[model samples]
Target: MDLFEKAAILQYRHRRIGDPGRCVGWCSTDSQRLRFDVLCRVGDTSDSQTLATSVSTMCPSSSTKRAGAMVIFHAPDLCRPACCTPFFQMDYVLASGVLSYRCRNALYPYKAIRQMWEAATRGPGFNLLAANVFEASHVLCGQNQHAILAFSRTLDPAAELVTGSVTDDFTLLMRRRAA
Candidate 1:
């Protein structure tokens, strides 16, 4: 189908599933996903690209901005494996790099990020390292300061916790709802 068709379908799904169109997405493949079309950033790591998609200070805290600890979401053309590993790290740096957060490809138990901003001295990128061997289930990204959802046996997003995977349904939460 064409982009318009995909967009129409996405908007339909977003409204049905309860996600706002203001939600942006970025990936390294044509399947990154949005209510519109998919845009991938594979090789061109240009400064403009980084600036246009940086979520570093969308809802910034004083500490984060001061530290320049931007959580950049980088999605290559690879699908995240199932979120069942007790101890795993989505390393971004070559020798030893760890994402400020711990999440592989969000497509699995969570959803992927649409864009990012990185410093030159920081090297390539970051990784999503995680270790919860004691927990009996997999943890999903809940998109808030308390962004974690545990699943004991099923990865079904529709099961009380999730409406669907971030990749498929686009029911992702970049921020939390206020009380």
Candidate 2:
């Protein structure tokens, strides 16, 4: 189908699913086309406040300027074997990265963030690290090491939890010690 046809279908589907459009964020191979279509439907009033509130409650520090739900895509065989489940998963390995707040905002907490990451990684989903290019600085500067160690003690016992410079190439893979 053409871009317009696909957008119309998505809109119809979204409406059928009770998703009011305003509060939904989509990440697809054709992001530009999707965004254009969504914007065209901006005239339709949808209360995104509730979604913003929920997101704020989970991550209180996150900016609510344009808060919305994320819809990720995961193709087969791209994620870890354990992630091959019936849940909606994103391909973190192929993702550019994620953008999150440094501190807990109104919507989420440290525990919640860790749980989400663990859950995503444990299943057939996106790689949180791969989807989050800025995680290195955000975690290191935000002292997320302590949080990580606290939540997953068995993963890194001798973690020093020191402040480090944030680099573009920073990935969670380097935080591990030799086995």
Candidate 3:
């Protein structure tokens, strides 16, 4: 099944998201019904302490000033089985509700990040993160968890557009874009 399918099975235990095969994720403007797609897992990489730390640090649960998030994100790379990354890229559109997986390529290079970022920072405490997907120094594995973490830390402290990804250790890291 696809990512959206996984989410639907996870959230609603079904495989229909807006359409049949072209689904991405779920989207809703309603504040009462929030969806957690980025936090879901598909394989052996399940829940752990590191994951909790990652989500809390990267994704802002809520803001003291604002009410909720404009966007929450994760990318499966540009290759088949897109795999998972530690970079959490979210863009929030005020009062527009959330939208998810609309196509197989929905997670393609710089998809919804741009539109959401533009709308999110229109007010205070609004932030957008950006980061480059880099290869880790390890010669044995293709896992880029460490690479993503290091990349996130190197971002500008004021970088509202940081990239978030799953760590090599199965942790999630979403922060403001590095400089």
**Using TM-score as the measure, which candidate wins?**
2
What is the full ranking by TM-score, best candidate first?
A: 2, 3, 1
- lDDT for each residue of candidate 3 in 58-139, tens digit (9 for 90 to 100): 3323331134223323222212111122242222222111211223443321233332233222211211111233232211
Give RMSD (Å) of candidate 1 vs. truth: 16.1
RMSD, candidate 2, Å: 17.7
Better of 2 and 3 by lDDT: 2
Preferred candidate (lDDT higher): 1 or 3: 3
**What does the lDDT read for residue 93 in candidate 3?**
22
Evaluate residue 123 in candidate 1 and report its C-alpha lDDT on the 0 to 100 scale.
21
- Stretches of candidate 1 above 4 Å error? 1-6, 9-57, 73-148, 152-179
Model 2 lDDT per residue over 1-179, tens place:
23453354345434535332332222332432322222212121122211111110122112222343232233222112222234633312111122222223422223433333343422111112222343333221222333444543444344222122222221132122324
User: Candidate 1: lDDT of 48?
Assistant: 21
User: Candidate 3's C-alpha lDDT?
Assistant: 0.25
Better of 1 and 2 by lDDT: 2
Q: Once superposed on the true structure, which residue ranges of model 2 sit more than 4 Å away at CA?
A: 1-99, 102-109, 121-141, 154-170, 173-179
Best model number under lDDT: 2
Q: Single out the weakest 10-residue window by summed lDDT for candidate 3.
A: 48-57
What C-alpha RMSD separates each model from the true structure?
16.1, 17.7, 14.3
